[model samples]
Target: MSHNINGKAAGKFAAVEQEFAKNFAERGEVGASVCVSVGGETVVDLWGGTADPATETPWERDTVSIVFSCTKAATALCAHILVDCGLLKLHAPVSEYWPEFAKNGKELTTVQMMLNHESAIPAQREPIRPGGFLDWDYMIQRMEDEEAFWEPGTRNGYHMVNFGWTVGELVRRVSGKSLGTFFRDEVASLLSAEFWIGIPDDFSQPIAPIIPFVPDPKMELSPFTKKLLTEPQSIQALSFLNNGGWTPNDPEAHKAEIGGAGGIANARGQVAMYEPLANGGSINGVTLVSAARLAEMGKVSTATQIDATLLAPTRFASGFMKSMDNRAYPGGDQMSAVLGEAAFGHVGAGGSIGFADPDHDLAFSYTMNKMGAGLLLNDRGQSLIDATYAALRA
Candidate 1:
């Protein structure tokens, strides 16, 4: 278990580094990196362990991985930028931009409804072909024809794979740019961060293949987890698997922009991407949104409701997940995040996460190669946040 942990920690944030290291030795971290910024300044940037467990490739400073749902935050930002430019309206019916979407009782579906997972198109009527994810037109056509699982804008559910297309198409119609291009040109390039919605054909970078974690055979699943596992036909199951059932090993996947789950980034990349949100919608003199627009976009517009797909009480403002006042876990089983109420961002499946804690002027990101079982912040990531805040408070 002897591995060299790379990167530096500010003297005040030394405890954060300790916890990050502890995850490798004590917890089951195979490869991971954590970056935290305060007042738009990076105070902690750390990476360690093996990048490829099979090849025993040492994790380099630039190693990145597929950050799952954390990609949603980037997609959400694209919409907010358009909103800031007055090019898109939150309350306008989506049919205003894409006429075909108005059919099937969806005439009333608004941009905001889609943003908050209330549009009710949570699952595909028929599972898309394995490679259909790369076909933007094919996917959007499927969405247009699919029936809403519930009345649009009436109930909340985790959109899982669908959120990206719902929002990405809107970005396309209004911005005249694909979500990947828009994000790269507007956000990533300006910030000088290495993040990609779809890993470009010519782009080359060191990316770790996600290593699935195997649990002890004797371990029993909670009732909720058991149901989600056993129900193949349920919305919960379809939400994740309908689109080719993603894996980091798929080289072609990097070339497709599945915004809901297909983001590629290092921990530093995520921190940089969120730093603007932590610093009033701009970083380094590059303005993506006005202060007024930021205030409106960051406000919680959805009622605190349980997600039908995730089966957890959740809250969202615009497109980012707001900290829940109640537990986000099943039966109040676990805390969804360790940040403050003012925090907003997203967690990727398998424990990667990135967020902006405006209350503390902090933006944090954790990315890893090893996948863990959980719908929220796993202890490995939570411990780093707990230590960072504890050090700050002390």
Candidate 2:
């Protein structure tokens, strides 16, 4: 089936359109959307596949899906805006804004630590119940009272569930509002994007459930991983997942206000929101953050090693992943190799990804309802990205 490619830039990206159509027919994608913008102009906007498992309704351009960790980029943007406004400091110890964070020797943890996943606060020693994340105060208090798994600034671990509480607490303390409120007012409202850190009731109907990849019961782990899992903290996180911590399906699960991974957005909304940062944080006269601060965000943070908690060889900037010497995103090794190190963005769980390639003045976002096997970029997503760059060169 053919899909619609919207906006004027679509005509210039015929290759991209053709690839989208081909993937929809050939790939096992259920529903997804891919969008690209160059020099502040959206070029490729295409979406197709099914919105649900039954495959009855076609995925519309406006169909929203959870972008998992991609929400971190949007959440980071909120903090960046505050920093730009001289209301906060990136390097300042988080305790300066949120005092309770000083507990358990976290007094030295900076805002940058939270963004770079260096805070060592992945989850609580005691597991949190599925729906219990909705109560903001309860979560923050739990974090405040819990001991850090590792010393701050010594290593990096993907703060999976705890990052939301860590960063959201800062947003709340400084802005006198929740992260969701701050994100809605500063980022989403300014860009006219439907992305939500904590989704609202009105938009709940369109949220897609996160389908987990098939679990390999006999998955092998390195010795280091084995020891890490042996820790009491690791056991708690496993128990949470095993007991359905990350598998909640109710719309309220999406609305439970987790800033690190609970965001929901369509392709267009994600593109529109991130294009500003790709083009120096100001789009169409809407300057969400100063160019200087935005540049700081893109600066690489080498305080921690690449092979940290995520178990992936990824280099992270402040909040986004840096496209180091490797091709972490779509477009295969050749295109990503040529794309260089100027690109930065985040990938969501499943197959969703959002990236900004400043070298090409491009911002691309892909969100999908169907979960894929790979943890990193999936095949269908790579094809779309390759087609996008190919079209640009054509």
**Best-matching candidate per TM-score:** 1
TM-score of each: 0.95, 0.87
State each model's C-alpha RMSD to the native: 1.8, 4.0
Report the error of model 2 at residue 54, Å.
2.9
Give the alpha carbon lDDT tens digit for every residue of 1-394 in model 1.
4567999999899998999989998888988999999998889999999988778898889999999899999999999999888899999999888888877777789999999998888888686887888788888998899888888888888888789999999999999999999999999999988799998888778889998767666654533356568987788777766765556678888878988888999999999988988888788898878878777766777855457887666778888877653443343423366577788898888788898876788899999988876666777988897898897688
Which parts of model 2 are misplaced by more than 4 Å?
A: 1-12, 215-248, 303-306, 324-340
**Model 1 / residue 346 / CA error / Å:** 0.5
Predicted structure 1: lDDT: 0.84
**TM-score, structure 2 vs. true:** 0.87
For candidate 2, the per-residue lDDT at 362 reads 82
Clashes of 2: 1
Error of 1 at 385 (Å): 1.2
Off by more than 4 A, model 1:
217-224, 325-335
What tens digits encode model 2's per-residue C-alpha lDDT throughout 232-349? 4563334225222555356766777777778889888889887888898789988877878777777778543344554445467877766533344332232121223677777776
| Sequence-dependent TM-score of model 1 | 0.95
